[model samples]
Target: MILIAKIVSIDCNLKCDYCFYHRWNQNSNRLMSCGTLETLIKEGCDYSPICAQFIWHGGEPLLAGLKFFEKIIEFQNKYRKNGQNIVNKIQTNGTLINEEWAKFFHSNQFGVGISLDGPKNLHNTFRKYPDSDGSFDATWQGIQILRQNGIIPGIIAVINSANVIFPQEMFEFFIDSELKNLVFNPAMIKDDISGLPTGIVAKPTDYGNFINRIFDLWLKKDDPKIEIRQIKSVVHALIGGKYRSCRFKSECQKYPTIECNGDIFSCDGDEQNKNIRFGNIRQGLNHIFSSEIYKEYRRKIQRLRISCLDCQWYKICRGGCTRDYCSRSQELPKNYFCEGMKEVYQHISDSLKYYKILPL
Candidate 1:
């Protein structure tokens, strides 16, 4: 099980416009205490029979300071059971990465993912520091630093209004930057459980067009080393491989996310809902996993499974992420991006057939 620990809660250095956690009242000083961290590590080690991946997530995880991570490594060594593997990964804004941080990640074998939402103009449109200055320069510098340390950090670019319209440019930017490991997440607006859109939402067709353009470019590449996570997941699904991405899976994986205060939720999507809180790190995973609330959450997903059983792209789309459901009712809770997703999936399937990768 992957444990997504929000080590610093929602306290980020940059104020990104579409951040889901941006609405939270974050106390910058609030960080995961050593005591809380130790309990989490011990419980996590004991629970996972095989590999335990600890994903250090945050408003900005580095805000917890470098020393905080040193403690994490120390505790992992202390509590890990014999023959049990432990892995660490950090998702950061990349504005704070320096030589010291990059070297630390490289030394400890931590998977680093930096958020870069395209080139300066598009990226700076949303990702800005407290002083209202753009963060592209700092983030780009961080990527360079990581590369210099022989660490190729993965890039996470969010597809929003600013960047979704320029798919080819966005694809070329990543290719030109020599940062090929990419994950492009379409920006989604907040929707109530009853399936009502409450905020500005990106056009689903625009996102589909964006991915199609990128896919065409990628297909034409002499040596397509560019790895777009969403496209890769779709290709894997078409080839009869499991789509491991949480966004497209039929059933949501139970990856618990721990808040800075040690409060645990089944996943990041349930973070804001107080009713869905499983328990706290101090309460142990057994208590959290066994909680009635979590059970009910799992039960709710079954409806999606039933809803998508008849879908032509059921295997590839898997009803989309439950979190992306426009409605959470017992009735069909169609995916918010269903139309666009269908178009994209069909395009990919047709392309595969044309290439003779799949039987025509």
Candidate 2:
């Protein structure tokens, strides 16, 4: 079981236009308390069967300061059970990463991922500081520092209007920067009250085309080391393996996201949705996971719609993310990105068949 900990809450330095977190009131600068952190690590370590994976998510996790992470390492080592592997990963904007930070990540063996949309112009279009200054230069410099420290950080670029139009360029940007590990998240911002996707979200067709371009570029490459998370997941699914992404899982399960105040939500995508909350760490992981509320929530999310069940790619795409559904109904949900998902999956499947990875 992986824990997605929003350690610093929604207190980010950069104001990206399409960020879903922007819908919530982020005036409060709440940091996860020491007591909460200790309990989380202890309980999380106890609960995880083999590996206790902690994904340090943000509103800029680095905003919590380096000392907070040092304490996290201490707590993990203290509470780690015999033969239980502890893994830590952080996703950051990369503006704050200096030589010291890079060295620390490398020394600790932390899996680092940076949020960069693309090259300077495309990245700067939507990702900017409060003063409206573009963040590409600082972020790029941070990437350089990490590389100098012998850490090739993963690039997590958001697919929006700015970068989506230039898929080949975006792919080249990463290759040029020597950032082989990549994850492209489509810009999908949902309306708070209505639960309908709105505002600067990439159109289904646009996203599908963008992904196709990247896939073509990827296939032409001589390097097998270049790993794109979405593409890898698709390829894995085509090879008769389960979709590695949470969004495309055959049955959606609880990969809980812990808020700064210790409240545990069902998924990172639906953190703001109050209905999926599985109580706090103070209640203990056993109590939270075993509670009737959590079970009911899980059941509700796992129910596949008739359309999804009838689809040929049910095993590959499942129903996609429930949160990305155009309608909020739990009984009969339809993903906003269904067309795009199908297009990409089909593209990958055909490619695999051509390469003789799949039987004709």
Candidate 3:
């Protein structure tokens, strides 16, 4: 479905090592009241087509409790002014997951995604509770419940520099587990410029290199159930097929993200970036287009940097997610990530000289 609405909740229990949100410090938001939800849905029904989705996202959505989510689903069930149909889904860290949440998911037809990195070490390296206790045991305990209940859990792993070299290990670890689907999102860091040091910036080529390594592993598998968002998007375009996407997929459309505190942004990538806020969720996403703050955000998306426009990778990367490229400024590029992509592409192309899986 194209028109999807995300119910955003801020404030998470876990504090990971490579947490960009913490680096940005945008997590001090509260619960979204029912009245705000009603107004937003009513406005969306006026603008969008019939097929719409209600995706619950958060610092930790389950932290809002199951009863709050139940109320949300109930609102979706009745919140129709025109032909808008809402399909409920949730992407959650499997901490508070229990039989109760699993049952609610099954009955509501919600697609469940769990945040799980590889084995305990790789996961604990970044993802852990605020108290610094490891979360693997509790997370897996919930996963086991979902498995027993016949609810398929989609896996989401954020790659840091350490695990970037081990695509085979990442895959084998997931394959050995019950996970049949996985999404790989590289770690995103911000420029610090805080006390004495600047933030750690992630280069585009480094991200590209990481993607290429995963592509290599994917080649080895006969029929991959793993669903990589970036490669799958490219493959969908190459094969002349269709694919599902959030607001981030297309350059033309700006997806709206509503925070629990009543702030709204163009998309999820702009979640913490201070420059993207446009009006309150009490108004509508339509306000984003009209608001002056969002105009620059849209402007940055439309006007490609001079160097990027001429680059060979532009067509494939589309400047590597507008929010990512412009998270710092409209002018500068993450030369590191871009160069890493080139290096990774060459490595893969060279490897293909000896081993060809997809017809070259």
Candidate 4:
């Protein structure tokens, strides 16, 4: 299981228009206390059956400072069980990365994911600073620093309408920048605190075409150095590989996100809703596991929609993210991107046949 620690709360330096935290109005000055981190690590390690991955997320995890991670590494070593290993990963905006941060990450063998949309124009369209200044240059510089430190950072680009139209360009940019592992998150439209639709949500078909174009570009590469998680995940599962992506998982709520103050949420996307709060570290993992909310989430996952069950790509998609289904209706329904998912899957299967990457 994965435990996402929102250590720095909703304290980000850049204001990305499509950020879920921003739309939810999750502004906070809270930083995770050492005691909370200690308790969380101990509880997680003790309860995990095999291994636990702690994904440090935030407004921006680096905002918590280097000393915080130093102590976290120490605590991880101190509490880890003999057979159960603990892995740390951080998903950062890449603006705060420097030589010191890169060195520490490289030395610890930490998995790093950097957020970059594409080239300057596409990226800066949404990702901006407090003064409405573009952050593409700063972010790219951070990526370079990590590379110089001998760490290959994974790229996560959020797909909006503006960038979706330029999938080839995006793929080329990542290749040129030496980014290997990539993940594209389709921008979701959700009601903000004021009940207005927030961010530039990509049309379902546009997202499908965008990924298809990227797959075309990905297939044409002689080296095929880049690995897009969105495509690779489905391909891996279709070929009977054991994978753990929430998008293709039977239960999306298996991974719990713990807030800075120890408030546990079912999923990171569901953090804005107080109703999804199960139990905190103070209450113990057992208490959270036994809660009705958690049970209901599991139950919902098991009870797949008839439409989803009947769909050909059900196994690979698994009805997509549960949060996407329940965002507005307050109920777990069929995935909103059902058609788009089908299109992408069909495209992938066809490409695999043409390239002979998998058995037809």
Candidate 5:
């Protein structure tokens, strides 16, 4: 089954230092209305497979109210008779989570991921409410509510200079809190957008060192609950096809991303731009895969450039993340993710040698 992430709410309480969406307040978020959501889910279920994973992502999804999400679950459950299956997950900042939220989420068996930077010193360094109050206290309090309800929340740590030195500390915090299975994504910024540099532009070597540090802790630090950010791509590669796109195992696999408001994009992360958009939700899913817009996006993935074609790591890298490539560079030969992929590939290769998952 393919993974589908939807935006439940555009509203967010915190105005983080590097919020790429530039979210403002409760009103800023444009939530997915019930009509659009129903249509999308119904259409999405028509794929060959009966079971699918749905992830709720947003400026802050909880602001949409638990009732709205329940309605979605109910709708999907109704379609289960037709062999449609849906698994729920949410990516939130944890500010809105409380006893009620925890109960609903845990009872529903949703995988919840909270955005926390670590100790108060590091968390408050960049992540904060618009009023300039520190978010660590409120977020941790929310996490406490989840734990009380018997739901362990996974962490989504953005590696910034502010928190770079605290990776070990963060792992320790997770261990003490008894939370395991975390994702460590580096801070990402757009060239057109204004924000702090994404942790001082760590070159490949710096990233290699960072990976080594993480492995150091994972192997020797005695932190049983901690797992670094490798699940998504590694699992994807182990699974699918091979026409193109370095990101996916096979370009022919056709994992499409549907945006809120009836719009579709070639990919999820970089769909805001009109240029890359495919079709609207009103359109049937069948037509989108064959449309010119999709063809163009697919072609771009196939023919990235001479340099990309020649690179030894091109196939596995899948031309890197389009958002990171085009947004950070805004031009060719300057994908900011170049360094990151280099580090990831090298480390994974080294790791595989030790485990015999790849060539020695």
Candidate 6:
């Protein structure tokens, strides 16, 4: 199971156009307290002593500062059970990272994920500071610092219409930047859920064509060091591996996110929807597991929608994200990216026939 700690609740340096936390009004002055951290660590240890992963997420987690993380490491050491292992990961907007931050991250063995939307031109289009100045230069500098410290940070790029048209350019940017690990998230615009003005959401056909072109580029590389998440996930699923993309997970609630105040949410994407909040750290895991929201989530997981079951890629996709379903209606609907995902999957499967990386 994964526990996402929204360490800083609401503070961020750059304002990315498609930021979900900002759109949902989830930002605040609230930050996780030491007592709350202790309680969370104890509860997590009790829940799974064998293995657990804690993802330090945020409005921008680094805003909590380096000392906060040092304390977290201390708490992890103090509470962790014998033979149990706890892995830590942080997802940040790369602007705050420096040599010291990189050193601490390296020494602590933290799996770092940086948000970079391709080249300067594309990245600056959406990711900017309060003054409306592009953060590309600062962010790129941070990425270079992390690399200098021997930390290969995973890159997460949100695909909006601005960058979606230039899939090849985006692909080459990552390759040229020497960024090997990457994930592209399609920007979602839901009027009912976000309560924000609709941004550029990629059309299914456009996204499919973009992915297909990138897949072709990915295949053509002779000694590929790059790992584009969407393609890699599809390839992994095709070969019958237990990959960890949430879209493919049978039960999304297994990975719950905890707010700075210790409020437990079913998932990060659904954090704004108060209806899905099961319980809090003080309530204990037993109480949370027995809550109505958790029970309902489990029920939904067990009973796959009829449309999803009929689809050929159902086993691999698992009907995609629950939040995507919640955006449209009360019932669990098929994935919003279903058509585009199918197109990418078919393209990869066809390409695999020639490479024969996995058994036929």
- Clash totals in order: 0, 0, 10, 0, 6, 0
Model 3 sits at a Cα RMSD from the real structure of 3.8
Q: Write the per-residue lDDT of candidate 4 for residues 147-199, one digit (tens) a residue.
A: 89999898889899789989889998889878879999887656645333344
Q: For candidate 2, write residues 74-183 as lDDT tens digits.
A: 99989998988889999999999998889889989999989999989999998988788999999999988998999998888988866778998999989987889998
Q: What is the TM-score of each candidate against the true structure?
A: 0.93, 0.94, 0.83, 0.92, 0.82, 0.91
Ranking 2 against 6 by TM-score, winner: 2
lDDT of 6 by residue, 90-112 (tens): 99988989999999999999999
- Tens digits of per-residue lDDT, candidate 5, 1-360, equal 343444543457788877765533545657788888877766666643467667777667787788888887887776554555567788888988888889899888988899998888988988888888889988999899998998888888776666666567877787677777766665656444542245433344444455556665675755554555543454235333223322433352254555567676655554333256678766866777678877877666555544566777666665654444443334444455566566666666566567766656
RMSD each, Å: 2.4, 2.1, 3.8, 2.6, 4.1, 2.6
**How would you order the candidates by lDDT, starting with the best?**
2, 1, 4, 6, 5, 3
lDDT score for residue 41 of model 4: 90
Question: Model 5, residue 252: what's the lDDT?
Answer: 23
TM-score of candidate 1 versus the correct structure, residues matched by position? 0.93
Q: How many clashes (backbone atoms < 3 Å, residues ≥3 apart in a chain or on different chains) does model 2 have?
A: 0
Reference-based TM-score, model 4: 0.92
Query: lDDT scores for all predictions?
Result: 0.82, 0.84, 0.64, 0.82, 0.65, 0.80
Return the clash pairs for model 4, or none.
Answer: none
Tell me the tens digit of each residue's lDDT in model 1 across 58-177.
889999999999999999999888798999999999989998999999999999999999999999988888678999999999999999999998999988878888988888899988
Candidate 6 lowest-lDDT run of ten: 324-333
Against the correct fold, how does model 5 do in TM-score?
Answer: 0.82
In model 6, residue pairs whose N, Cα or C atoms come closer than 3 Å (at least 3 residues apart or on different chains), thus clashing, are none
- TM accuracy, model 3: 0.83
Off by over 4 Å in 4: 23-28, 193-199, 271-274, 302-306, 326-332, 355-360
